[model samples]
Target: MKLAILPGLSLDEDELEITYILASGPGGQNVNKVATAAQLRFNAAGSPALSERIRVRVLELAGTRATRDGEIVITGRRFRSQQRNREDVIERLAELLREAAHRPAFRVATRPGRAARQRRLDGKAHRSGVKKNRKVRADD
Candidate 1:
């Protein structure tokens, strides 16, 4: 199965290693007996589906979830069912990849307009005038 992230990027199911583990918290007795949590490991750094630029962004965005080996480990235990958890992890991974695929618009450096600079200077002058007025006159 291929997971489509962006228009050009798709990840093969083989690239993902998913395992089931026992989930902690809030499942009562069922939590101990059942391994419902899904752990997904994806080698983002080594994936052929990603270009160098997208790979770097994905790893950076993964933050602490990414290992030094360039594998991104995502644990999904939000749902009680193994299938739901599996789906959750896959969706999360897709979201991460989608975000990384986006390129931010280049920001052009801009200077303040003449009117804006004048307004700022006028405000400063007004403030200076107010402070000057606060001082007591020697003649008074």
Candidate 2:
């Protein structure tokens, strides 16, 4: 199974390493008996599916979730069933990859227009006049 990240980018299922562990929280007796939590590990840095730029972005976006060795570790315990948790982890990973795949448009620096600048100055002047009017006169 391939995880489609973007239009032309897809990650192989073999690239993902999934392991089931004991889920924490309110599961009564089933919690101790079954390993319902899914832990997924992906080597984002070493993956051939990702380009150098995207790899860097993915690692940066992963933040604390990424280990020192460039592996992204995601744990899913939201569902009681192991299959559901596995799906959840895969979905989360896909979301992260999708985010990394998108490149933000370059922001062009712009200065305020002459009219805008004038309006700002006018507002400041009006505020100054309001403050001036509030002053107690010696005659009063």
Candidate 3:
């Protein structure tokens, strides 16, 4: 099984290992006879294909996906057929990798626009003028 790679990063199928286990749900004798649930294990800590930074992010993102032994585990059983479940798992795994592969876009520092600054100054000036006008004269 294979997953669609993200735009910038490419992953080989060899990096991913999938196992199909008996699905748990209604299906009569078919449920007992066939395996439908798909379990995918990817070694993020050991994969040379991914950058160390991306690898670390992957581990962080996976969280519960990793086992005590440190293998990422993703399971799928939304579909009754093993083929469909398998595809779902692969798609999900690819998405996870794509998310990890992404780096946050650089944010450009920006100051308030000229018009915005002028507006703020205008508001302050107006407020000050109001306060000045509110002062009562001694004669009044």
Q: What is the C-alpha lDDT of each candidate?
A: 0.97, 0.96, 0.83
**What TM-score goes with each of the models?**
0.90, 0.93, 0.72
For model 1, the run of ten residues with the poorest summed lDDT: 1-10
lDDT over C-alpha atoms for residue 53 of model 1:
97
**What local lDDT does model 3 show for residue 17?**
89
Show where candidate 2 strays beyond 4 Å: none
Please report how far candidate 1 places residue 22 from its true position, in Å: 0.8
Can you write out model 1's per-residue Cα lDDT over 44-100, one digit (the tens) per residue?
A: 989999999999999999999999999999999999999999999999999999999
Q: Which of the predicted structures, 1 or 3, would earn the higher lDDT when compared with the native?
A: 1
Q: Number of the top candidate by TM-score?
A: 2
| lDDT score at residue 56, model 3, on the 0-100 scale | 83
Give me the runs in candidate 3 sitting further than 4 Å from their true place.
1-4, 68-70, 121-140
Compare the candidates by lDDT and give the number of the best one.
1
**Which residue pairs collide in model 1, if any?**
none
lDDT of 2 by residue, 1-140 (tens): 88887899999999999999999987889999999999999999799999998899999999999999999999999998999999999999999999998999999999999999999999999999999999999998
TM-score of 1: 0.90
Which pairs clash in model 2?
A: none
Compute the lDDT for candidate 3.
0.83
**Comparing 1 and 3 on TM-score, the stronger one:** 1
